[model samples]
Target: MKCTAVLAALAAIAITPVNGGPIAYGICQTGCNAVVVACYAAAGFQFGTVIAAAAAPATILACNAALGTCSATCATVALFAPIP
Candidate 1:
């Protein structure tokens, strides 16, 4: 299911802070990366352009916010370790 990628991307935006080690860092990196990508994909950027570019501004804006939020999450996780 290709659509399953972003199925819960937005809902998974909020992540709790947890003191973790290597494994946690790996999960954080992978998880946050996936969420951020899914956020953009949900915003219709996956195709390299906006599909309904002007159809729903709110939805696209929400996705944009989600992108920022999820990217912040990635930054937060980066502090967890060297997520490179």
Candidate 2:
């Protein structure tokens, strides 16, 4: 269960687009790393609680913003979630 959650979080991070250009992508990656770290720090190595408490909000926000604000095609590219 924990492994599955971690894998899903990793997959989500892989798909999310950074806010800016290449540099922004790097920063976003760093931010994602921080988030992951925070989750682990708070929840220990249990992937389900960590990911649910941390990544879910960020992911949902990104997905919603991408869907509502972006153009249709752009939203499709930006928030390509497996579940939504």
Candidate 3:
């Protein structure tokens, strides 16, 4: 159990962004609101007003590449992973 806990913590740390690191927001401002919206939409969340509320940050992050905000090598793994 101790080992499992340690591993989990390490995994979390691995995914966390580094200070001064560049994270792509895909053409949106800080926090990548636009990319988050698109990601949510592509994930099939497009519907009513709730869509905006639901897909805000996530969509922005998804579109980070387009925005040229995130680093290609570092953000690649985290960006592709399912929303947390």
- In order of appearance, the predictions have TM-scores of 0.37, 0.31, 0.22
Could you give the candidate ranking by lDDT, starting with the highest? 1, 2, 3
Whole-model Cα lDDT per candidate? Answer: 0.50, 0.40, 0.39
Q: Tens digits of per-residue lDDT for model 2 on 1-84?
A: 132343346446665443323433333344444554455445345333433535455554444344333233323332433321
Q: Candidate 1 lDDT (Cα, whole model)? A: 0.50
**Model 3 per-residue lDDT tens digits across residues 1-84:** 122233335446655544322232121133334444565577566523443534456654444444344233224433333222
What RMSD does each model have against the real structure? Answer: 9.3, 14.5, 12.8
Q: Please tell me which predicted candidate would have the highest lDDT against the true structure.
A: 1
lDDT of 3: 0.39
How many pairs collide in each candidate, listed in order? 0, 0, 16
* Candidate 2 residue pairs in backbone clash: none
Q: RMSD, model 3, all Cα superposed? A: 12.8
For candidate 1, which ten residues in a row score worst on lDDT?
1-10
Which is the winner by TM-score between candidate 2 and candidate 3?
2
Candidate 1 local lDDT, residue 60? 61
